[model samples]
Target: MEVETNNNNSYLSVVRRSSRRTSFPTLQGLYVSLFEGEITSDGLDLSISNKNTGKEFNPKLLKITFFLSIFISTVLCLDHGFVSCNLEYIEKSFGVGYAQSSFIGSMVYMGFLIGCLLTGLFLPVLKSKVLLIGSLIFVVFSGIYSSKSLTLTEIYASRFFSGFFQAFSIVYLPLWVEKFSPQSSTTTWLAYQQLFSMVGVFFGYLLGGILTCFTAEDINIYYMSSSEKLSSLFISWRGPFIIQSALIIPIILILIFIPGEILDVGDQEQLSEIEYSKTTGLLVSGVDLRRSTNNNLLPDENNLNKRNSKLRRSSVLLIPSQSNNPNSSKSLEIREICSNPIFMFSTFAVCGVYCFTTCTLFWLNQYFVEVIKVDRITSVFSVACIYLSGPTLGVYIGGITGDLINDYHPNGFGFILTLCTIFSFIGFITSMVVAQTHPYISFFWGMIIILFFLTSTLPMSLIVIMKSVSSKTRQLASAIAQFSFNFVGFLLSPVIIGIIMDIIEYFPFGALKRRYNPIEVGIKIMLYISLPTFFFYSLATLCSYFNCLISPKITQKKIIIANQIDIPKQLFIK
Candidate 1:
């Protein structure tokens, strides 16, 4: 018998000669194929024997899980958009000033920040589904409680819990999605997940608008007296909470349908490896291979003696690699992340961006009503249009561009974000100029145009943060970005904007006095504050480029790992 064992050889053909007859067998293959025992052939049909042990790939199961997780998570995001839009109505209902009323929205974000921090710490210990279900339950109860709140404190408390639950949904849901998806498709799946989230935002706004409009009309239609109508309209704000609560029931039921087996990340990884092995006609299961080392292989006697000496010499680099180790290098990584100059700068940028965005949105409705003298319906519609255009289209566009840039070139995503920031500055400047010199129509239209581009940065910032940070640290990264951006805005918005308005009110000097209209003054302050966003983005772009150059060692390590796992061509075939 003749046997061939060479990497470059295309086929392995064996011929056996016995006293009675000659036998031949052919095995066509690529790459390595480990086999045991001898083969004999007699110029006839050859039978090749091999054991099969591995998991099967189920594409259908993957798709179903991805879709359901995204849908459920997006429901919470929708609620966020709805609550943000209804802040004005909420303020009027509770008889609070704009600053205090802004708390209703800001409190929710605060809760979200806390939830994200907690979830990130606890996720590895807790099952993903348990966290998701727990969050959903919190949301349902919060939504129901919010509808019944009579006092501002009670409302704020409900919103805080609602925000907390929403935060859990945001952080954990994507992690769950990433757990199930193939590595090659991780970015694509994440992008689609974000796309659905934007859709949820669109729907949330639509639902909030619909509820507010109908409730207002119903109040007018049912109550003949003006005072009675006003009283009835006051209660209309609760309608959205009720509707949103009702919408969540079906989502809960859908969550139940998702298979629990698919939710385990470790199990999925093992299964993926097993499936790859099986498809390539391998006889060894990945799990078995892992076990074989521990179960059957004995430590070399000489190697065992040398282990102590090696341990002493390599103790500096031999630290335990367990993911849960509190004292592990990951802690150092976290410290490094915290100390990162780019991260600090980006946090400030995020704060500035969110503050301006939130402040503008919060005040625009009132501005339309009081200064521009537009009807409530027109103001609401205009405000909705401004928000709706960016998040809906801009998020998807941003996510796609981010993925494309990351895939093709290092730091390209940062360039895209910088461009977005530049556009935001341009938009803000144009809006300010228009507000100063143009007619109400010109001002309104110009502001709308500017707001569209300004809001586009929301998604761009999200993508930028995701690109800059590693996957393991993304939760904290997102939390820091969201918290700093939002908290600064929350703290400064009411005070700074209030002070600006107060200045315009008390001073009334030269150009400032001439533009003493509260709405115009608000717009002017927004315009001035918005200039920093451009500066920050410019800084981010430069930082990202430098970080990329300085981080060559990390990139080189990843490339080395990638090359080592060349992903055998035979494994890819049927």
Candidate 2:
């Protein structure tokens, strides 16, 4: 069971662990073993080698497997986009009004919020892979059950469970990808994770659009009751669940055969050095005291008392390791991050940005169909195209540009993000102004270009927050930051937008209804008024981020110096 590494070279040597272990451990056995008290306090150790190799999987296989897993798991991400695109059809099929149908969206978000909290609780104990696999199973079951739903209550329950389970995939997939990826390529891999999730969203839009074409045209189902719609064979509202299930099953099968982690043989020297330092007690993980003996810092090694006390104070922070009482240290770190103004401003900025994105995702299709007077097919295609082309491209552009700027100026990333948000704010206003007269043009200008600008702020703000915190707290900080944004964006935006739309549409005004249809007027007014609030709020948050960056008390000089002094890569999070 001993792991072997060559002293002469950096490569890890293979040690065949077994011959009868023909396949990787089953998900059930993995969880059962942990539940029976085999768990490690340091956290889940899923790096157990592929059953056959004893060494890490081939690099190419590892990359393929990781990307494929992300793609498959994100099939659950299709829920919102699919629902948004087909909301009208679903409402009609269920014989529900706008206010009543909003509950379905609310249920999904509620489940998602609850799921995230529960997943976060178990994240440090269970293998993320097991949570991911278990969540996918429940998601598939929910999707199938949803497809066969007979009543509004049944569909709500199905959607809630689906959202609940999908939360595991959402919160864990990025962390899992980061764990397996090499340090150098971590950002790129995370970016791809975001990209693939958007790709899933596009598929959701496309799926709903395509299936909606199969609606039985002979019968006017819009006027029919819920029971009448249910009797029909071609109810398009159920199609997304069935199609998503078909797409996800094969991916889950493939992932079970793939290994859980990729061993980074390149970090062998660093790993050995840390182990040696731990035993000698001369160096902490982030401190460079181990190198002091080789350099002029400790010239008189025999007379250890001659060593400078100031040097020790400057180099090491002496924090408790995870093997010790992790709870105390984690609590302390959480308090530290939460109290820091930089973390707060940047987190809120990201939250606002995400809330804006979610609003568009849930309402843009309805806006186009109802207010802009666009055809259903064109509206769906336009929304899909915007997602397909906007957010991913925006993230790449922002990430690369922000990296270059941060290299030259410590706060340059925030500066640039602020400017982008201002531009996005302007774009949002202009789009709403022009949407009525030039609807198609607004789709291109408002949805695509504005998103391109606004979405870039996401990665920029994330990097700022990541850099602001200490390395020991990076993982927790990142989790908490994401949870904050998702809570506002996913759990709140849609229902609020729907409520506003209903309030405007259903207001008592006999004269106004006679002059212009109340429903159309309400939707048009809601489209014009409701969506801009998030973008404007996001702009305000970015301003706060910029202010925090330039404040007198805030400084990154020490962190930058640490980076410049060749601190090991393990001490930094991108």
The most accurate candidate by TM-score is 2
Off by over 4 Å in 2: 1-57, 216-235, 263-330, 402-439, 509-574
Residue-level lDDT tens digits of model 1 in 378-466: 77777666666644455565555655554443323446556666776776677567657535567666665665565556545655455
Instruction: List model 2 lDDT by residue over 453-570, tens digit each.
Output: 6676665565556555543355556567766766776666566666655665556874343555433444344345424534544554554454433332222123221222222212
Model 1 error, position 69 (Å): 4.1
> Over the full model, what C-alpha lDDT does candidate 1 score relative to the true structure?
0.53
Off by over 4 Å in 1: 1-57, 78-88, 177-203, 213-235, 264-331, 410-441, 444-448, 451-461, 489-515, 547-574
Mark the 10 consecutive residues where model 2 has the least summed lDDT: 29-38
Q: After aligning candidate 2 to the native by TM-score, how far in Å is the CA of 136 from where it should be? A: 0.9
Clashes of each: 5, 0
